[model samples]
Target: MSDVLLFSAGLDSFPAWHYLDKPPALYFDLGHRYRDQERAAITALVDRCGIEVSVSRELDLSRWEADNAIIPLRNVYLAMLAANRAERIWCVGVKGDATADKSPQAFRQISQMITDLSGRPVWLDSPFWQMTKTEIVAWYLGQGLPAGNLLLTFSCSRTDSAATHCGRCSSCLRRWISLVNNGIDAPFETDPWTWARVADYYVPAMRDGTYPDHRAEEFFAALDAVGFVPPPPAHPATAEDGQR
Candidate 1:
């Protein structure tokens, strides 16, 4: 068996793809709102690379109503499915981003469980376990992976049949913030939207107890905890200078 990857076709997963050099990629369609777009983006990414990597799809529909973005025990199901095909499986989990099914403890227990259940040595690997998504994007670029290829990947949590990003969503906002902080000129508004704008919305919401809609406040608070302050607005004349 070959190595397997839980590829999600987002910024985080791309670095794993780059470093792994196109292992067999496994895509899960767990009835997330963005599954169609994510699947399409993954197909496009593999096609663009022209690499001989196998992609397997699993459609496991769920009706859990926690968040449209979170699938209950998603990584566990993905790991279980992947273990049947490969002795080693990799997922793009990063530091400080663990959920119930994605924590270090969970992966360790799952690895042991897979070995015991399958009666073989099964390994679950996350090479980027210590890096944040933003850091992974930076690492990918530093490795000379083309930014244009990355632009084709999708991360927005909410999109329509057309696969257009809803700019107001927390995922969209996080994408924008991460790219800007890493000095990537992602195809977004050229107008100077700042962390200050996020604060202006988040502060009052926290006071009135309406802040954590879909954990938007928590997301922004993490960014703030990392000490991201808004930069000063540049002169309007230089806005379109194409300097990134």
Candidate 2:
């Protein structure tokens, strides 16, 4: 039996793909907006590493009407389907520095749900679950993986057909800020206010007594270091929208 990787064709998954000892099975489809990039990345990865891939076009959940961030329990469903097709061990590309809400706890819940539904033993592997993004990047580089292709991997929550990145989404913004902080200019660095817009939502909530009082100072301090001024509030958006 071989391991199965829930490959999303993003930066988070790069390191896991490189380090898998079993040459795990990689899954992908045409549903996701970044299908082209995903396919290219997976193909290149397979070529470079000689890994086995089992592609399925049957599951195209991205077209269905659903929320952008939380796509109607998509991962849980994907994991269950994948478990049936391959070995029960599944690897996901989730990192600690990304956010607390989308933490390992969330995946644990999904794993438990899948086990309950399938009535079979399954493993959910998250190699970077406790590691920061910086650590992940360093690890990939240390492994001699193509670190340059990282810029091409899409992480934007917003779907865009015109550009490689949907700069307005929280994922895109966070990624841009991280690259900037790490002194790496992202490929889609055209939008300067991407991270600034994120700070906008965060700063007001902290200042107006909406966020925890303890976090206000730390938030503002980070913004100051980044030289960003948050924008005015538009409407009450959930933490999933702004932070996740």
Best by TM-score: 1
As a whole number from 0 to 100, the lDDT of residue 94 in candidate 2 is 41
Error of 1 at 201 (Å): 7.1
- For 130-221, candidate 2 gives per-residue lDDT tens digits of 55555566666666666566675666655445546756665665566455544466765446344555555656667788654444554454
Cα RMSD to native, each candidate? 10.4, 7.4
lDDT of every model, 2 decimals: 0.69, 0.61
Return the number of clashes found in candidate 1. 0
TM-scores for all candidates: the values are: 0.75, 0.70
Model 1 TM-score, 2 decimals:
0.75
Model 2 lDDT at residue 124: 62
What lDDT does candidate 1 reach at residue 135? Answer: 70
